[model samples]
Target: MKAMKRSTLATLINATLFSAVAGTSFSTLAEEAQAKSNQLEVIQITARKRVENAQEVPVSVSALQGDNLDAYSSAGMDIRFMNAKIPSLSVESSFGRTFPRFYVRGLGNTDFDLNASQPVSLVVDEVVQENPILKGFPVFDIARIEVLRGPQGTLFGRNTPAGLVKFDSVKPSQEFDGYAAVSYGSNSSIDFEGAAGTGLTDKISTRVSVLVQDKPDYIDVKAPGFEKEDSLGGYNEMAARVQFLYEGDDFTGLLNYHVRDLDGRPIAFRANLIEKGSNNINPLYDNDVVYHDAASRSTQEVDTQGLSLKLEWDLKEHTITSISGWESAEIYSRADVDGGYGNDFAPTMGPGFIPFSSETADAIPEHDQYTQELRLSSNFTGDFNYQVGLFLFEEDLTIESYSFDTGTYDEAAGNYGLQNGYAVQEQETSAWALFGSFDYSVSEQLDVTLGLRYSDDEKDFYAKRTDNPTPWNGSPDFLEGRANPSDSHVSWDLSATYKLTDDVNLFGRLANGFRAPSVQGRILFGDVVTVAESETTNSIEFGVKSDVLDGQGRVNATVFYFQMDDQQLTAVGGGSNFNRLINADKTTGYGFELDTEWVLTDELNATFNLSYNKTELEDDTLAVAVCAQCTVTDPTYTIQGPNGPEARAILDGNSLPHAPEWISNATLRYTKELEGGEFFVYTDLSYRSEIDFFLYESIEFKGEALFEAGVRAGYAWNSGDNDYEVSAFVRNLFDEQVVIGGVDFNNNTGMLNEERFVGAEFKVKFF
Candidate 1:
């Protein structure tokens, strides 16, 4: 009954929103309401390493600007907010907000290790962030954001089977400009972001930006004999960026340096809250703000520093560009993995549970990354254009993880002589690629784009056990080994665009992409070593970009299909929570995306986007681990399997985890001119269809449709040459409880979404 209600509610809300937008569009068309408030701005992107109108780029991409960009950052500076606003994108993280895993069109990796490789690529200012920790870098300052869908192999090279999220920060200019924003919200949360830029000389200009956030904990512990000192959900994080630009008669150089410091609590896992094979929260466990813990707090600390330089020189009819980047970080996080104390783990028993509480910690004290790229492109206006580039990347990382028993408990729960089980892993990776592309105009109305890249990657891995804490563990020196793996692949893409009219175009694209091989060696008390071969994907897509209703509306749509061979997947192994990397035979995905922006009136505007994708494993002999709390409903649920009792389920037709069948986001904004300023009201709604958290299809491991809404209202005015605005906003207005990920090894542990936020914001601009 609850599932029915939730589904019905989502359908109704979506239907209502769809009808309203359609009706408004039709009504405006009938009345000829093309009063031209603010025409949709032309979005320019660098998807092809050159500036071009997004509509003419022959790619399926979305660009957010102005108020939309501001609203997204205001909701949350993390990349997860991009998932909520953009269609065909989803993000999940087991290691809190610092390590986010992204999925696009149902293509992504489920590995949570620091060195895990992902098909989806994240690029900030043309620099790729290879590590999961670096992907969590905060989004700040001005400029635009672009989400490119489908396989971006030709330009991005390896690990781009899914696509890319590209961020372009505002640059310095000769004219001075700056802005500041501050907000205070519920749970004693505070957010502040500001940037200032100015020209120092005829050849030099600089800009500085900063972001800060503080929030108090909101969870209360109800365990017996445990006093809740303060909230466990609080956080204090700060990030800053400095950019310098030097412009010459024939050359230009831009340098950027950034740093982030964070102190907060990671995601909390709730125990035994999810029912078997379903998204339904067990009614018997109705508490939402209560948690049990043996420790005072689950704490985390992270520090990151990065520097990048871009240089370009004009060489007659062509331009030469070079980019060099380096980044380093250290992170430490500890959490209550069990979600409860002794009563929950070994109920009806005394202090016998050795851990007293199941606590896990991960630390990465050594991490470094370097990248260099050199490219040359045509600068002349002609029927043909070309670009060629060479790229090199290197990384060094070390991680230490521990699952320990609290000292307060006795030996009944099986505590060995050691204090905890610990593993140390070290990895070094190097990659190089050569890529080139050509764009030719077959005629006045037709264009063709061809691109190709050859990439080679190698990784050196070392892992060993530092401690053994389990009762059954006899080898204190559990595992110590090294692996050196190398992979080489060829990626290519072909596309053609035909101009149907001055205001419309049609395009089709075919692309192939690949990800490097992976190694998993986080073994202390369990299995030895596990490794997965490289994976590759081929995709075909068709799309249309148009400006309709006499410049009053714009629409973009695409349909795509992809097949992945030798897909890398994660599986649970042996005792002591060891994870193994394996390769599945094949998987396929098909989807469609629709995006529309309409000017309803001179003072009102509306934008709607929807994406639907379906994915399934094509390998029939593949068996996967079932949900920890699943109640076997499939008639073929057999216990006889080669991968132990826990891994006895077949996943042949299962949809990919974290891939929702449907995702939609809509926004409406209205502006009114006042005597002294402009007043505006904005609201947005986002919805996602049912999703599974793991490969196997089980009732308790899936969630039904989820919906979230936000609203902001503000007034803006100008004083001389300065601008100012004040606004009040509310995010997740209804406080929807959504489950994003699951921990199936240790009971039915799950992670929940953030709570509601209500706040008032103030901003000022000066030039």
Candidate 2:
């Protein structure tokens, strides 16, 4: 009976799709084809702070819709996983997924400091997330994701010397629509998410979304002191969002609230990755770590909440929009610092030598952020259009560090007598910007755009320390200081686009961007206070967007060159673990990117994306620390006279860290019509050339060329207005052991990428 029912259902779905397409009249089908011959599917974007067709925009931008975005994010709960699908983008996290750092086009910060600022900006719903911790909020229930290459200074302001990533959520709509995608994979990993929305009144609507991910441990525990089984590398995360919308005769308003909770173990690091001279991994190792002193298990939790309100009013010839937002979060992470058993270090530190077990705990117990923006835009149907806006932001952040005690050291005074007097620091930041953009269509085939922004930024920092043997409280004896630094700058961009034909556009753009001044005051452990002046970048870019093959294929390509002055870099000096900020004289780079999408036939589609970047520090005097994780690689090379036999792993003319020479992503999809449903197969491959993890490249901290692939086969059906799908998928199809990052601080610690997983997924949609 069950088999009969399944057969009947399949027939119903096949008939529905077949009739829907075959029932069309021959003349009507021909007319539809003619209408689509010279036009590609229109994709709308807000890259210019206003609604515009992506093809008509004169910027180098890539966008992915919600359905396609899920394909990338489904592999992991963190946003960093999307790097595989997007060219010109790379991400790595030293503190785990909650602190992912993003790099675009060879521009990014390699600092592990909590207060470090990134060149790339992450904007969600028009609100900027300045803190690195806040940027890790998982991405779910999104409307679209956009990546803008090069400097986005005029619109986004500071910390965007590289580019910007934008995420827009699906807003509340009058019609009810929602979907759920659930999957169960290897290691008992489960993923489930869903959203639904409906009208509450003639002019009001609401939407609610939730996401949950749970996974069990996969790594085994094999150590003398720890006897637990299956107790590492696991996670559970939950997130939800609510949105409300109201529309009146001349006004529209949207209110949204979101919350997230995460509990998990971050990425694991393997010790003894390499020795002193060479940059290769030691062969006498397995995929596991020894933890006789500790359980080799890390604990981390992050809680985040946010609220935003958006209001828009229509005037006779202009429109006004306002956005106000508030966000708060508390995060804590604790882990074994040494990444292995401590027995080997007993003879190095003398009579005080403990078993070498060490652990560090970091917390952001208090954090709050608020922002407001207002804009006025031209709404007239004319050749000239403009938008002027004001933006304000304020934030208070605090960070604390703790080290645990091990019996081999002082029990009363704490671990190595260094646990109690660790560190405590706080910072308050406020910023504002005034920006405007003008657009004019000079003629039917030519257009010009100009934008300018003036931004002001300020930061206040406070820090204190104590030397008491016990847990030290805030004391006056410890080095204490406060600093208030402020900076202001002007950024601008100019662009011109010429329509080569009805189906192609050629454009060029020149832009400038800046990063605000930075201050590091982790003075509790060390008495170092470092400050960096603002960094700026000037870019020149040219691009072309075209639709060919009778609208069956679309292509976008861009070439860009940029020069940055006073590039802020982090240097760990004075033989301490603390890092300081320094400014390099100059750095320059050039890059090119290409994206193409083709529909080979009625049933097959293909896409390809590629990017290449090269960058170098021009300042000959700049020498960066080498072998940060592994103290030994190429020890003999430090005997040069350039800086008096200094150990410099990163020197002048070295390509920027985390900058891969080549990155490419390709996808192929095929679909076939069935009786009551459709069957489809999809596959994708991503390749990245070798990448360095630190400014001073070390043999042990660089990843060789790696390729990752995934494949999925699915069946889809339609019942009335609802649709359903069942699919089986395999991630990391070849089980490639790609090393995404490394840790050289303690005996060559290395972090590996995700392992292979096979799973089945079910999805349903209704409208």
Identify the leading candidate in terms of lDDT.
Answer: 1
lDDT for each candidate structure: 0.79, 0.76
TM-score of 1: 0.92
For candidate 2, lDDT tens digit of each residue in 200-253? 999999999999999876665554444466666788999999999999999999
User: Which residue runs of candidate 1 sit more than 4 Å off their true CA positions?
Assistant: 1-37, 75-77, 276-278, 282-288, 343-357, 407-418, 473-476, 572-576, 632-647
The candidate scoring highest on TM-score is: 1
Q: Quote the lDDT for 71 in model 2.
A: 71
Candidate 2 has what TM-score? 0.89
Per-model root-mean-square deviation over C-alphas: 4.9, 10.1
User: TM-score of each candidate?
Assistant: 0.92, 0.89
Which tens-of-lDDT digit does each residue in 88-160 have in candidate 1? 9877788777998888898887777777888899898889988888889888885888888888989988999
